[model samples]
Target: MSDALRDRCEELRAVVLELTTTTIEAMGKPSKLADVVTVIGKLRAIGDKGAAGIDNPDYLAWDRVYDASLQKMEDAARRGDAQEAWRAFADQETGVNLIARACTGYPGW
Candidate 1:
């Protein structure tokens, strides 16, 4: 991979890890709209950054999945439903893993 693409991918991978850590930490505490909003912000940032790798299908798919998950989390947070927010967050873990894994296969182009 070119340095730019590799850099973008690595940055995305790091952010994904950060998001996971933030969520896992939140899981140990009382779910707050603030906490969920924090995750939503991170997810938004991730989506923005992931756009750098948009030519890659994995990145594109990650964007799609993450957007959907972000929306779900936002809806729950907006409703002040901790249980639903947590459920949406739990459902998002798979896409989080996909995002991390996606960066590992960036091709040289």
Candidate 2:
């Protein structure tokens, strides 16, 4: 790939990372009411573009991570532990990165 194309991909990755961090930060409050669906929608769009860029399977792994993360967040909410919910949400960012890296064919998982 050309340097320009590689740069564009890096920029997209940065945007995704920023958005993910913002989502996690927004969830810090007890009743923040973060629009998780919207965030997820954006992520899905990114995932689609990323899949094309990487030419690798992404949907299955991405769905697994996304579902598990949401479930963890829901469980925390049900338990009435805002901090735990935020922590879980933040932790899930790791999964997001994993998926992103895998999409780009990062050497190791």
Candidate 3:
């Protein structure tokens, strides 16, 4: 993998986890809702780009999991569903962990 790819992986991980943090912090504060929306948008943009060069099936599997989590999160945010947000975050956390672990099988990983 290129340094760029490695960096992208790290960036994706940070942004995904940031969503969880943003949602948690936004729970009671109406002001933080904007931040949550921003993070979700950022995450969606990153995810929609897909993993360009990575050819691993494991990575793709993780991506699918992450995408589903993102969809769930997006819907939950729209409805202001905190419970579903929590569940989605759990799924995302697992997906992120799987993604990181999957990276270990690659060249520089």
Candidate 4:
């Protein structure tokens, strides 16, 4: 991977980690809803920005998975369904792991 692509992958990984941590920490806490939404939005933005200019099929596939998960999370958030949101976030976390593996040859969790 080029340095820029590697950097973007790292950035996405960090956002995914932070999102996962925050979601777990905020579980059952209504006061943290806004924060979770913000993080989700940030993750989506990162995914959107990084999705362009990738010619690798594996990475592209994983990226699509990530985007789909984000959409599910967003829909759940809009419906005020925290449990579903959490599930979607978990799915997204998997996608993030796959993306990391595809981009950096790291063993996925």
- TM-score winner: 4
Backbone clashes in model 1, listed as residue pairs: none
| lDDT (10s digit) by residue, model 3, range 4-28 | 4565666666775677677777676
| True-structure lDDT of candidate 1 | 0.62
Clashing pairs in 3: none
Best by lDDT: 4
Q: How would you encode candidate 1's per-residue C-alpha lDDT over 1-109 as one tens digit per residue?
A: 4465567666565555555565555556545466667767866775765565356565566666777877777787677666676676666343555555556766421
Q: Count the backbone clashes (under 3 Å) in each candidate.
A: 0, 0, 0, 0
TM-score, one value per model = 0.62, 0.42, 0.66, 0.70
RMSD, each candidate, Å? 4.6, 6.2, 4.0, 3.5
Q: Is candidate 3 or candidate 4 better by TM-score?
A: 4
Clashing pairs in 2: none
Clash pairs of candidate 4?
none
Q: Name the lDDT value of residue 99 in candidate 3.
A: 60
Q: What's the lDDT for all of these models?
A: 0.62, 0.51, 0.65, 0.67
- List the candidates ranked by lDDT, beginning with the highest: 4, 3, 1, 2
lDDT tens readout by residue for model 4, 1-109: 5555566666776676777776666577755656678888888787777656666665677676776777777677667677777887765344454665556653222
Per TM-score, what order, best first? 4, 3, 1, 2
